[model samples]
Target chain A: MRYETLREQIIALELGRRERQFIPIGLSAIDDALQGGLDLGAMHEVTGPAAVFFTQMILRQKRGGAFWLATSSPNEEYYPPGMAQYGGQPEEVISVCLPDTKDLLKVAYEVLAANVVGCVLLEVQKPLTQTQMRKLQIAVQNTDSLGLVTRGAHTGTTSPERESACGSAITRWYVTVVDWSHEKTQIELYLVKNRRGSPCRWIVEIDHATYDLHLVSVSGE
Target chain B: MQRMICIWFPFLESERLIRQNHDLATRPFALVMREANRAFVSALSRNAGNMGFAPGMSLADVRAAAPDMLYFDADPMRDIRCLQGLLRWASRFTPRVSRGGGHNLYLDIAGASHLFGGEDVLLEKIETQLEDFGFTTRLALADSKAAAWGFTHFGSTKSNITTERLEGAARELPVEALRLSYASTALCQRLGLKKIGELTKLSRVALTSRLGLDGVCRIDRFFGRTAEVTEFARHKKRLIEEEQFFDPLATNAGVEAALERMLEKLCQRLSGMRQGVRKSQLQLDRVDHETMFFSIQLTRPSIDVNLLKRLFLHHFDQIDVGFGIDRLILVAEQVAPLSCHQLSLENSQTQNREQDLEKLINELSNMVGARYVQRFFPVDSHIPERTFSRVAALYASRLEEWQSPSGTRPLRILKKPVSVLLRDGIEKMAPETVFWHGRKCHLTPLSGPERIEPDWWRDDPDWRSGGRDYWWAKADFGALLWLYRVSDEEKTQWFVHGLGS
Candidate 1:
């Protein structure tokens, strides 16, 4: 019933004549999970350890632009390798390493106000407060740029304010590193909340050696 | 004879304004502070002496004279700036006004005296205007800077002197009216030259020898005997252009479009004057008289409309547009004369290349950012990092295109490489096992113990853990990582600095 409504809207708007929106991280399962990639001009929370997936997603080659805010590792030397892992040119990558939460807010708002960067990733350990998140959401929406915040496991801890920061995030995804013993390390991704669509769980295998992710086929039919 | 006018404010008034408060203009206020046994009044408010207050009077004596007077400490430098601002405002009348030695103005109204009717009318107009603005000005007119400076000091109290009677009246005035220093005044007194007419009797060389060069020059200038260098106060150009919006712009696009219109008008004004602007100040006025101002500076003199638009495009989102934007203004400043480039037929090739380079820079800047789009240039330095300085948003060609002197450098230079721990004191000696980030790892193979010295000039002695020696070490499982050891006062410590992957 939902698909019929969406199809009717697309047909009514004559969207078939237009080209497909080619977002780089267009995995079928992830797209369906995200309800058609991250919405333009919105905030998404992708929480994990030293989030390399978020890095790749932001560094994706696009005609527009990409921005990365890495705070987990303060050193600028670590950015090139992560960007190179996704076949993105290191020289072309723009990353801002904000030292603290205050600086993060200042730099993020500036990036949004510029309206240059198509994708923005802010990696922070402690989750932002509701006020901070509210301010950032307004900046992103006003600029028409997609903003992603990466947080650690305790992002949704007992502190309701901390939970509210993630709650204000348009979508939230849990990225947990699963050890496959002899097999390559796999990242088990769980869609915690989908504001636009239904939530689902999926396993994506990551080649630790090559730093690549493969979406696994669920045993259905 | 031609005429000039002088306006004198007693001491430095503007500098002591904050302390003087409302009393600065109305009451007989004096900014008095004692340095030694002598009490000196640094600044005096309007009609201070008229209200029976004099500078250099003892604090006790001043209290006896005007007991209800207010006092303040004076700053000479700030008063000079405020005076300059007023002089700039006055420049609209004439360009020949010169700042006097001590809180006085000297205007060479010689050729341009007829603009404001006669010299008396002009002086009256100036005095009345200044009086309306809460300033007490003592006005005088004469044929020369020295002659005018002389009359205003002495003649203003004696008789009603106008520009018509200045030359004859100047001759009878005391030589002390010339504003000569103590030595010059003493020399004039010793020579029995009590009047301007008596000093005019001496030869140029004789007068110079007796009164010194400055005194001779002033005397010569006032008498029209020699040339006088009258320094005029510079006029700052006020280039203000504004756009009145019918309906306040609420969207970024609307504001940006409005700004573009303003920028075009401002650039046209600049270019029409054969000038290229280095900086432009933009003001966005919203409802209720709130103003948002942002200024942009070009790396070089630029009149290109597209470049200016691109730079301002980033700041459009910052406008509030609260209750809607009512007006926008762009002011051209730091403008310079731009020489037009004559193009040859072959110049088209070069122009096309420049256009391509500009496009590349704009695209890269848009992709990364204006702050991040940088170009590195080689410098005359032995150190690797010091060899280049990042130039933000440069449209020049890549630096590596030109051949450079070869130097040894690391494939991966860390942005602040981590401090490490060494097992033993030896640098070349391989670590059998190393613990890093709470994990123990065995080394399979090792290479390099390159020493890197700390920049002693920049390194803080308190925070200095000492110099580091980096090494490329591989684990048994084929995990290649970079490690470094900090040689400190106690011992060396090794740390897993970075991973090759």
Candidate 2:
């Protein structure tokens, strides 16, 4: 009887894994490379100069409340009116300010574990260990929540070994501004690590009026 | 005749300590008050009293007699607050409740007795509830406040004295039952007047001349000859639930279990009242006479026990159980009426999602702090930084619709603008090259010199450089920066305020 109960429990666990959904990024090429889209209950890392804008754009696609965690440093100011330009409602976004990186990650873990909000964005200034990243990964694994982490600008280059060391995140993207003009701003997203598919790059134009992402070019799968 | 009930807590201070830490109830406990650097027993438990320790006895003598006695400094203010809380709790039995001194509560249940059966049942109910709360109370019901006070102190633990028996009851009690001044009691004892009946046998003029008018009036008031006025306490009943444990809880799981049960009871009470809690406080009384307090606030009033439990358990690690926690009290400090909503058959998923969002907000608010988690609201101001304000997420009810400014704002704005150095002198409308972040970069003005002036009425240090002409400029590295130039009297200063992309 115990063996049969254990077998039934394993079946339920498998079904839960199969039922996990994917949140599409609204770009066909990028979504195709991501195997339909980003896994709904997983961690994704974004880093670079335009990483905040890219993260905000991805958060705009989700349906529920979003939490943005940042440190209390004077340099880390998030302009809500500017964020509204990226289709994030000022009222729907809950901004949390912690005193340090440790508290930022702690609150991020709590927010992800609750599985209530649709997305959590952590502005981490320091590098995280594999254990820290793995803890956050496990927190969001069972919930329909997305954990989006953006590294600080001062943190130097992301080497391949360091990327492989902290491989708990399901996907990692490096954002760079390609073009800026009065009409539109274009950013290049480099998918350095994808657990499910090959790495690729996509150039997208940000619509300031409608706050939508338009695909311009795709390269290097 | 008005019916009055006087419930006197004989060992108020010691019992309050015992109520908080139940382990002290089994031991000999006393509360000491120091006068002129000499400690004296102010209150003693029944066990300590049985061990021959009395109030007003020197602590040194008590320690010599009973070396195993545990004592603490008496806090009269906390005792008074406890009495006031009991008064509020007793208001459920009758609305006309008043405090008769530090450790006594007077209930003027003139006609409000039938709701809980009759007078005897009401008195019994009050006694049982107080006992359940770990208070040893002596309750008495009589026709007058003086008579009720006299009976509770000197007559019986529980007594119902009628108008016909009031005279005889007063006759049997001692002269101290009249509650006279200390000098009058001493004089009465010296004059061989031991009982109220003996004092009443004396002539009125003789009594007045010997004991003074106030003392004579005290005797008159006891026998219903004169009316006694009492100031009723304006007691407001709170939605509260609490539990006392036989064994103190030393583990987080035990505390969480007790908290969960208390939350269930409190939520049920709130639901019965058709109200929801907006802010609630949890107090843990440790075995060492210390208290740990936590306050949980919600984004919206909620009666959901699971949400409250989750919010509270998130902070369970912070509870330092000094020795152990013997009592848990949950009080809803702020509540609002929650109108019942019929669940929509089709849109229940949406409702559940919204509820989930609220739970997330509450949990995040508690994890950091309510003030640290905030939502932004637009303000009707023209200043760049003053255009929006961050309000705590839990308290942001009605937010103004965000109206985009005419000029395009940047995705990230610097908290304080950084000054930029222009290589070329301030001759042109805009500088071609500027040094920022210790790097000299060429600037190409993409969009414009949108003029923004500071609020003239307010003194702002950041905006003291007068009006600024903001420009969306591009650096040589293809990064968009929000640059603004402030032309002061002496020189033209340029500052990079934000990042555009």
Clashes of each: 9, 0
How far residue B104's Cα lies from its native spot in candidate 1, in Å, is 8.3
Evaluated at residue A20, the lDDT of candidate 1 is: 28
Candidate 2: segments with Cα more than 4 A from true spot = A1-16, A152-166, A210-221, B1-231, B245-247, B397-401
Task: State which docking tier applies to candidate 1.
Answer: incorrect
Q: After superposition, how far is residue B56 of candidate 1 from its true place, in Å?
A: 25
- lDDT of residue B14 for candidate 1: 42
lDDT of each: 0.60, 0.82
Clashing pairs in 2: none
lDDT of 2 by residue, B33-53 (tens): 999999999989888999877
What's the residue-level lDDT of B416 in candidate 2?
82
Ten-residue stretch with the least lDDT total in model 1 chain B: B402-411
